[model samples]
Structure formats: structure tokens, C-alpha cells
Target: MQVYKAFFKIIQKNRGQILIYLVVFMVLALLLTNTYNPPQDTDFSKVKVNIAFINNDSDSQLVAGLKTYLDENANLVDLPDDTQKLQDALFFREVEYILRVPAGFTEAMLSGQNVQLEKTTVPDSTSNVYMDLLINKYLNTAQTYTTYLPGLSQADLTQYLARDLAEQSEVTLISNGSHSANAEKSGYYFNYLSYSMFAILILGVSSVMLVFNDTDLKRRNLCSPIRSATINFQMILGNLSFAILTWLVLISASFVMYGSFMFTPPGMLLLLNSFVFTLAALSISYLIGNLVKSRGAMSAVANVFALGTSFISGVFVPQELLGDNVLTIASFTPTYWYIKANNEIAAAVSFNADTLQSIFTSMVLVLAFGVAVLAVTLVLIKQRRVEA
Candidate 1:
């Protein structure tokens, strides 16, 4: 048909652009896929943390005992009596934790007064957790010692240790372990998703451009012998080709980056889900082209719709952060369904009858959207022909 011929001409002229876009997309996809390094599940050894303790009182025996205990279990450092130097070391992160003993720490412990031992450590450090466990261990040891003493009761020693030091021991955990490996992983995930969705802008722009192109060139085609439907069909095929190409690039990238052996058969399900999502994009793009006559105007609208919907749908950020209103609206977006499906597959959620049914639902919705767009475009063409 005349329309098919025209389409061939356009393809020949624009082959370069298609190739360039394909290559760029492929590279980006590979980079993202390669970055996905899942944490290994094993009993990993913990990092060593250095700790400094300053004894205020001359409790040589108590200090020696404590130092020996810590040195055996943890990396303990004895610092100068200078308080300012200890503070500087803490600020510099040279030590994971610092402990301070009052002037009468040893005397208080001997006098059966409640001794207040101070413990300091980097805030949120796994070291802090370990330190707490060690302190509890020391307490248990002291209780065992008291049980053997004829006159000393466990409570008596505990009270004496506290009163002698003026109060019970207070542990202060203080540096920067706020962000863990898992947190870093989350950041990477968000960044990858953000970049991936950014590419959707191309889809929007191309859709709008195609719409305007049809409106502008349609009159010229009407004068020729080719049926408009045939021309439209060619265009539709081109769009399908582009969508399929993009999906393949993404899947291939994942394989290249993670190694072909990483993703198993079930993992392939995520790729399939992503492919289904592309059909949704195709339908929406076709609808936009048929509805909008001005390329520039449609481009502007496309940007707004794509960005707004993607943001609200958790493509740009975590879906959990979005409130009920934004979340409720996001469900209507095709991107939401696909995103959800991708996540579910990644997490390896149980694949039951419900999941199969949901997949069928997604496919149905996408098919329906494509059919609607085709119907609308036909109606518009008929109207234009009648007017002419």
C-alpha cells in the first residue's frame, strides 16, 4: 500500500537515529544491571573497633582488670589522663568508643558503694552493641563472685558499686554508623530506578512527535492511492519494533552485568513482566499521537504526564513514602502495575493462582488500551476524511 511505502522511506531515512538510540539504551541497561550485587548470606566476621578508656580515680586494680577483659575480647586502648585529648580522639573517629571512670571509682567499688562506670562508643556502631553485651557479661561475672563471698550479697555489691561512684554506670554510644550496607544498597536501587524511568521521556516525546507528524502529512497521503489504515498500520509496526528493541536491550543489559548465570528461570519472569509493561507504554503513546495535533504542545503534555505519573508511582522514589492519596492515584497508572510486578518477581514472592491471575489481568488491561487507541485513531481518520 502507499502508506507502507511511505513508512519504508521514513525508516530508511531515520535508521541512524534508531541505531544510535538502541546502542545508548543498551549501554545504560548493562551498567545498571551490573551494579546489582546482592549481599551474600553468610556469617560474616565483624570489623574491629578501637576504644579508649580514661580512669579518673586511681583504681589501678579495677582499671587493670577492665583493661585485661577488654583487651582479650575487644581492641582496648589506654589513653593519657588528658580529657581534651580523649575528646579530640573521639571527634577524629580514631576510637570507636571512650569510657570515663570517676576519681573514686576504685574506692567506691571497694567500699561497696554503687559505682558509676561510664562507657562511650560511636553512635549506632555494631561496636556499641558488642560493648553492651560485654558490660553485661562483666556484671554476670561480678554476681558470680559475690555469690561465693560469705558476707557480701549480690544486691549489696551492686548498691555499693553505684553509691560509691554516685550513680549507676551510664553507657553513651556516640560516630557515624548510621548508614549500613543495606542502606547503601537502597540508595543504589533508587538511583537505578530513577535513571531507568528517565528514559521513558524518550517514549513520550516520540509518541507526541508521531501524532503531529500524522496530522501534518495526513492530507498529502489522502491525495495518494494508499489506504490511510495501511499507512497507520505501518506506523504501528514501527512503534512495536521500537518497544521490543528497548525491552530486549534492558534484558540483555541485566544479563551482561550480572552474568548470564545469575538470573534463573523465575528471574526471567521479571523480564517478561517488564516486556508487558512496554505494551502499556505503546498504547498510551499511540493514544497521545491520535489525540494531539500539535507536536510541541503534545511534547509539553507528555513530559508533564510522564514525570508526574512516574514520580507518584514510586519510579522516582520509594512507594512507601507516598501518602494514601498519591498511592491511590498511582494504581491507575500502567507503570504502577508493571513496577509492582517487577518488584514482586525480584523478591520472589510466592507464585500462586492469585499471581497468575494478576499477570493475566495486566495483559488484558494493556491489550484493551491498545485496542482503544486503535479504535480512536480510526474514528479520527474517518472524521477527517469526511470533512475533506
Candidate 2:
């Protein structure tokens, strides 16, 4: 009990450092959430492109009908027949397309002869292509009508060509039963939590363990009536208590920030995933404490492990942008599995066997890493004792 109390006292002394990390990360999470603003749904019917039309064709129903179609679909900007004004309009992006209907275009269409409409625009203009396709569709239908119905008058054909035949499609978006909208925000919070927890556990537990590893304290403990096994058990209890307390503080803060949403199926999976990662971090800290003899070295180890792993394992940057080689290397770390599982959870529609299986597989892999590190730490500790 005394040893456990002493261990907690060391952690309490370092509470300021732990609190600083927590506050900074929380502020960062809030800032990130605010920085990303999604645009509202837009009404496509209101969209109009500015276009310049030059009609050199003589008076005919077909030419008049084509001009009316262009006016209705686009904003027709009247410009003088000067090359300079037309070039300026295109350069300034005031008009997306300049369409010229050559002389005899109406006659060629009436006589079933091949005719071409000339168009000019700024290079690589997307709106220009859309306008071109619209013109082609209109003219193609007019050509078909003239070819098949020779008996119909030109006025009748023009009226038929001007009719709107576009089908209105209704789009309905469905949610996949997952909290995908909030998933990125949740991931940011938990990723930073893992980083802060790793550093805190290493610095807190290792510092206390160092005190116990002191030569005089070790000799005195050996001389005491208490068994070495009992002393080791107390140390383990202290470390475990500190780790659980740290995990709870972080988890609770997440809940307070996100509210009841944290209890949702996906959110619950995130919590469990983080818990498994915390265990892996604890084992890593234990290994580092056993190997490192000084507080300075332990602090250095904490920074390298925590920051390096976070950056490489998609905590700082998204996994989608990371290179294949980087992900392959990160696969060896527990943070990789934690982030990967979070991604899978965010994509899952329901709590099905497939989703659960993948998540459990990641958890198992994380536990395996912890167990392996702990086994090596135990062997190292036993070897050191034998040498002493």
C-alpha cells in the first residue's frame, strides 16, 4: 500500500505536464473541427453561363429557333464585331464561350448538307465543353426531324426542336447507419489522446520506477522481511493504477466534449479501440522504464516513440495520403492498427459479423504487440537481477 501511494505521489507531482498536453490537444481538436466548413447544397437550375453569340445567318425559322435556345440556356452578352473586345471578354472570364453561326447554316440544314458551327473559348474551359455538348444535342435532334419528316413545315420543325426534353432526376442521399460526418473529428481527438497517454505513462511510471531502482533503496528493500515478489507486485499495482487513471481522464474528457454521441455504436467501438491501444502503450512504457536508467533518457524515449509513431501511423496525416511503403512500416506499430480500426468503424453500416471480425482482429494484433514487449521486458529484468 505504501509503495502504491508513493508511486501515485510521483504521478501527482507530474500532473501539470499531463494537464498541459491534454488542454493543448483539446484546443487543437476544436480548431480543426471549426476550420473545415462544408458548403451548402446548391440549386443547379439557377446556374447560368455567360456566352457571346454572333449570328451571320440570314432570317430563317431554324436560325431564329437556335438563337432562342441559346438565349434561354445561357446569359447572352452582346458585343461589337471587334476581335479585341471578344478576346478581352474571354481573358477576363466574363464569357465562357463565343459561338459563331456561319452564313447559309439554315440553308445547309434545310437541304440536308453537312454544316459546322464554330466556337472559341479560353483553353481548358470546362463550361465551354458543356455548352458545346448542349449545342450538338439540340442541332442533332433538329437534323433528325428534318430527315424523317419531309412533309412538316419548317415552322413546325422549329417548334418541335425548341421543346424541352430533358428528364428531371430526383436525388435522395441515404446515411449508411454510421456516424461518418463526425468520424474525422472523433478520430482527431482519440489519436492525440493516444500520443499524450504514451508520453505521460512513460514519464510518470519510469520516474517512480527509477526511484525504486536506486542502489541504496534496493539494498534496504532486500534486507527487509518483505519478499521481493511482494515488492514487485506492489510496483505493478501502482503502475496499473496510474495507467487506468490516465486512460479514464482522457476518455472522460472525450465524452464531455462529444456528449452522448460517444456512446453510439461506432463511438463505442472507437473507445474500445483506444483502450486496447492504451494497453499497448503501457506495455511499451514498462519496457522503456526497465531499459532506461535515467529520467532524461526516459523523457527522450517518450518523445521519439510518441511523436514519431503518431506522425507515421496516420494520427497527424490521413492514411489515404500516406505512401504504401510508409503504411507497410507503420503496420508494425499498435497506433497503425488503432487508426485502421477507427477508419473501418467509421465506414461500417451495422454491427455485423464482418465489421466486428475486422475490429476484433485489429484488437488481437494490438494485444499481441503488448504481450511480446512485456515478455521481453520481463526477461531483461530477470537478467539484470541475475547480474546483480
Candidate 3:
């Protein structure tokens, strides 16, 4: 019927604008999903330890070798061998470990005597982890030198250990709890921002049109044979069709850029779950159109409200950084639900109490917002008709 015809007319009239918006969103989705360099270099700057040597010649080859090893691979801050300074720095949390080279260290090693060097470390400290790994690697390299020439000469063993230590590599752990392979926080950030920002733009404009036409032409259609309920239903169908159309375009772009990660249950679930926000958008648009007399005013109000919601809900940034108070307020916005759903999808393999609760809460809030806004729209429509 007439409602369907009116819907088609709107589509035909606005096809160019709609197509342009869809294209822009598609390009943005591709850009966001595409793999790119992380915000920082991949190299890990490891913490360095302090060493105080007694009767140790700083110019000795072994000392030079160890110094080079620390310089090239760690964040070494060289300090004098004063025991007072060393102990004070360590106690004050300035240093995690200290190395002590006793007198006759070089003579013992050169004379074939077994000399054990002392490396002091804090009982429990963050730097201890990296220090432990480095110490183990150095020890293993030392043992390997003992196997050289059936019995390694002290000088030869020192040389071999120094060479191995100089070339030792540092390891860093960047994880989000679960074993997600090479996933990074930046990829997740891009995905959610691209989806959410574009979704808001598309729905915001479409919602205005859907609401604006009702105020302008709905009364004329009311006098026709078609019932108001049927007209409203058809309008809903048209808006949903456009919403889904935009969604599919975005999904395709994401898939091309992100590969299989975009199709997993968590990822696709996020994309589909965002449709609830579209309903919320429609309802809000209805409220605005009913309250305002001009399309300009409606657009201004919608854009401002949409941006405000986007900011408060952490669509521009992750909600975790916003602290509890901002995050609590964010929970009431449909945009927050959409972004939360995306985060859950990114960490799908490690589903747990917090993420599951977030998913459930977001869906419930979106449904509630949609319902509340629709009820308001209905009230506005009734009052407008009564006044007329």
C-alpha cells in the first residue's frame, strides 16, 4: 500500500545521499580494520641492575663484556662500586639487583681456579623477572663453555660466556589474559571506533529523515485508506532495511580488512548486536522530530545528543580508562552497549564473569532505551494530534 509507496518514494528521492554515506562508511571501515603498525616500536626496553665490584678492574675484558651486554640489551644505569650507595639505592627502590666481583677474580679465572661471582637481587620485584631470565641464560652459556676443549681454559670460558651474553635477546610478554596469538589493543580500538562512529553517523541522518517526513507528510497520509498502524509498520520496515543495508556493507569491509577475525562468533555478534542501537536511534529521532518544528533544529539536536552520548559512553575511547563513575553513567547509553559488545567479541576465547555480565547488561540497556524512547514518541504523537 500507500505506506509502502511512500517508503519507496523516500528511498528514490534520497538515493544519492544515502549511497554517498554508505560509501564513506565502507571506506572508513576498511581503513580501520586494515592491519597497520602499532602506536609504538616493538622493542622492549628492559630495566637494568646495578653492580658493585670489589678489587675488580673496570678495564678488564670480562668487565667490559658484561658492561656491553647490559648496555646493548637492558636499560642500564651504571653506578660506582661504593657499597653504601649500592645498598641505599636498592633499599630505596632505586635498583633491583647488584653484582659484586671479589678481588683476585681475574687471577683465579686465569689460574684455573673455580671462582663464583656474586649477583645480589631483591626478594620480590618486577625487574627480578627479566633479571632471572637473563641470569639463567648467562649461566647456561657459561656451562656450555665448560664443555669446550674437554676442559675450558678460564680465559677461553670467559671469552665464550662474554660472546654469548653480548648476543642474548630480550623477551617481552604482551597479553590480554587468554592466548589470542598476536592480537593487540590497537586493533580492537580501531574496530570498535570505526563501527560505532560510522553507525552513529548513518543512523543519525537516516533517523532524522524518517522522523522529519512523518511530521511533514504523515497527516496527509492519515486521511487515506491506509491505517496509521500499517503506515508506521511500513516506515519501520524501510528504516530497518536501510539500517541492515549499511550494516552489511560495513561487515564486508571489516571482513576484507580484518580477515577471519571479523567472522568469529564474537566479532559478528558485535556487528549484529549493534542493530538494537539502531532501534534506539529511530526512537530518539521520533522524539526529536515530534518536539521540534524544523529539520535544521532536529539535525542540530540529534548531532549534539549523538556526540554527547558517544563521548560519555566511551565510543571514542575504551570505557576502562574512564573510571567507575563515568563508566556507570555510560551504561545507560545505547552507544556504550554497542562498544562493550565489540570488546567482548575481541576477547571471545577468554569469556569470563566480567565480559559475560557486560554483554548481558548492554543488550538489556539497549532494549530498555529503545522501549522508553518509543513510549515517549507515542506520547508526543498523541499530544500533537490532540492539539491539532
Candidate 4:
């Protein structure tokens, strides 16, 4: 009881720092969620890039058809044919791509000659790549038609290419209503939760553990009537209580911000992931608290451990965009699995056995990380006790 009382007393003494960390992170989370508004619907839509089209070639049905196709797939910017103006347009990001159709462009395609279409582009533009792919697809398909159908006229050629290109595969968004405004925001909160939760747990547990780690405090507790086991147990209880309270506050914030939507199935599972992650974070904090010999080291440990892992674990960035090597490295950390689970949880359109199995597997891996770290912490503590 004494150790437990002292544990929270230390927390109270350090309340200012704790409160600052909590408030700052919570505000940041809110701001980020507000700024990043994901689309409400999961419908597939092509990202149209701005392009400046300059037709050096004479008027022809094929060219008109090409311009119409560009219009359909991209945002064609009306820019003067001046070289300086086009360069400036690209430099200023007013256009992601530029196309200059040569005078014989249509004839070259009809003749099946290998003459390239002259083009300008914003350097290293992703949209430029897509535009290139699109144009190649059109030209290649048109050439194939011309080679195979020698008697086809230009108007007939344009008609055939347009019809062929119009065919597109259907895409279905298999998600569990994650596009709902509340669910999208909730997913963001959960992803960013790793950082704040890690920091707070580290701060809270380390503050208490640091105090108890003091040699004089340890000797005093040993000399007291309470057994070593009781002191350790009470300390564990205090740490767990603090961790649980912090978790509740965060969870409650989501519920408050999102209303009853938080009680939905996906939302509740999000809560479960956060809870498991909190335990792993607590174990990490315990290890850091014991290893770090002074209060001055706590801030460094918290920032480095919290922020570093957040960056590598798909908290700041997304797992989808992360490279395979980065993901492989991230897999070693429980934060990766936690975020991975959170992602799957949101995208889970159905709660069939297969989906649940994947989600539970991730959760179990996270818990395993916590249990393993706790075992290591116990071993370290036991070794120190023997030496003392």
C-alpha cells in the first residue's frame, strides 16, 4: 500500500509534464484528423491531372478524338503555345504534363511508322507517368487495329479505339462502412494513438518506477514490514491502474467526439486493439524505467522510443505506402502489428470467421510482445535484487 501510494504521489508530482504531453498530443491528433478528410465513398475514380495540350498537327478526326480522350481522362489546361509560358506552367505546377502532337502524328499512326509524339512534362511527376501510360495504351491499341484492319478509314479507326478504351473493369470497395465520417476519424485517432499512448505510458510508468528504483527507497521498503513480493505486487497494481485510466481517458475521448458510433462493432474492436497496444507500451516503459538511471533520461527515452517507433510503424505514414524492407523491419515491433490490425479492422466489411481470425492473430502477437518484455523486465529486476 505504501509503495502504491508513493507511486501515484510521484505521478502527482510530475503531473504538469504529464498533462502537457497529453494535451499537446490530443490537440495535434484533432488537428490532423480535421485536415485530412478522406473521401466518404469508396468508389474508384481516376485522379485527373492538369495537362496543357498543344496541337501542332492540322485538324483531323483522329486528333479530335485524341483531344476528347485526354479531356475525358485529365484536366486539360488551356495554355498559349508559347514555349516560355508552357515551361512556366510546368514550373509552377499549373500543369503536370504537356503534349505536342507532331504534324504527321495521325498519318504516322495510319502508316504504322515509329515516330514519337513530342512532349514536355514537369520533371519527376507521377501524373506524368500515368499520362505516358495512357497515351501509350491509346497509340499501341490504335496501331494494333491499323495493322490488323488495313482497309479501315481514320474515322472508323477513331471509333474503334474509343469503343475499345471505353471498356473498364468494375471495382468494388469491400469495406465495413469505414468510409462513414465517424469511422474514418476514429481510424485516424487509433493510428495516432500509438504515439500518445506510448508516450504517456512511458511517462507514467517510468515516473513511478524511477522513484522505486532509488536504492535508498528500495532499502527502506525492504526494511518495512511488507514483504518484497507485496511491494512489487502493489507497484504493478499502481502501474496497471494508471495505464488503464489513461486508456479510458483516450477511449472516452473517441466516444465523446464520435458519439454512439464508438459503440459499434468495428469501433469496439478498435478499442480492443488500443487496449492491447497499451499493455505492450507499458511493458516497454517498465523496461526503459529500469534501464534508465536518472530522470533526465526519461524525456530522451520517451521521445526516441515513442516518435521513432511511430515513424517506422505506420503511425505517421501508412503501411500501404511503406516499402517491403521497411515493413519487414517494422514487423519486429508490436506497434506495426497493432497498426496493421487497426487497418484491417477498418477495412473489414464483414465479420466472418476468416476476418476475425486475422484480426485476433494480430492482437495475440501484440499481447505476446508485452508478455515477453515483461518477462525480461522481471529477470532484470531479479538480477539487480541479487546483486544488492
lDDT, candidates in the order shown: 0.58, 0.82, 0.60, 0.86
**Candidate 4 residues 1-388, lDDT tens each?**
8778888899999988788778966897679667976665646567999998899888888889888998999999999999899999989989989899998888888887775887888778788799999899888898898888876798999999899999998777564543466666788789888888898888878878887888998888778899988987898899899999988877777876788877888899999999999999889889988998777798888989888888988998988898999989989999999998998878765688988899999999999999999999999989998999
Model 2 Cα lDDT, one tens digit per residue, 88-145: 9989988889999999898888766678998888778778777988799888887788
Query: Which is superior by TM-score, 1 or 4?
Result: 4
Residues 216-288, candidate 3, lDDT per residue (tens digit)?
4666766778787887787667656655655555455555555675565555556556556666765665566
Candidate 1: TM-score?
0.60
- Cα displacement (Å) at residue 68, model 2: 3.0
Give candidate 2's root-mean-square deviation (CA, Å).
3.4
Clashes of each: 17, 0, 0, 1
Clashing pairs in 2: none
Over 4 Å off in model 3, which ranges? 15-24, 35-50, 54-219, 352-357
Q: Judging by TM-score against the true structure, name the best candidate.
A: 2
Q: Which parts of model 1 have CA positions greater than 4 angstroms off?
A: 1-20, 30-44, 55-64, 102-114, 119-130, 144-263, 295-332, 343-388
- TM-scores, one per candidate: 0.60, 0.84, 0.61, 0.70
Model 3 error, position 245 (Å):
2.6
- For candidate 3, list the clashing residue pairs, or say none: none
Pairs in clash, predicted candidate 4: 176-349
How do the candidates rank by lDDT, highest first?
4, 2, 3, 1
Per-residue CA lDDT of model 1 for 106-125, tens digit only, reads 55555445666787667788
- lDDT of model 1, residue 323: 94
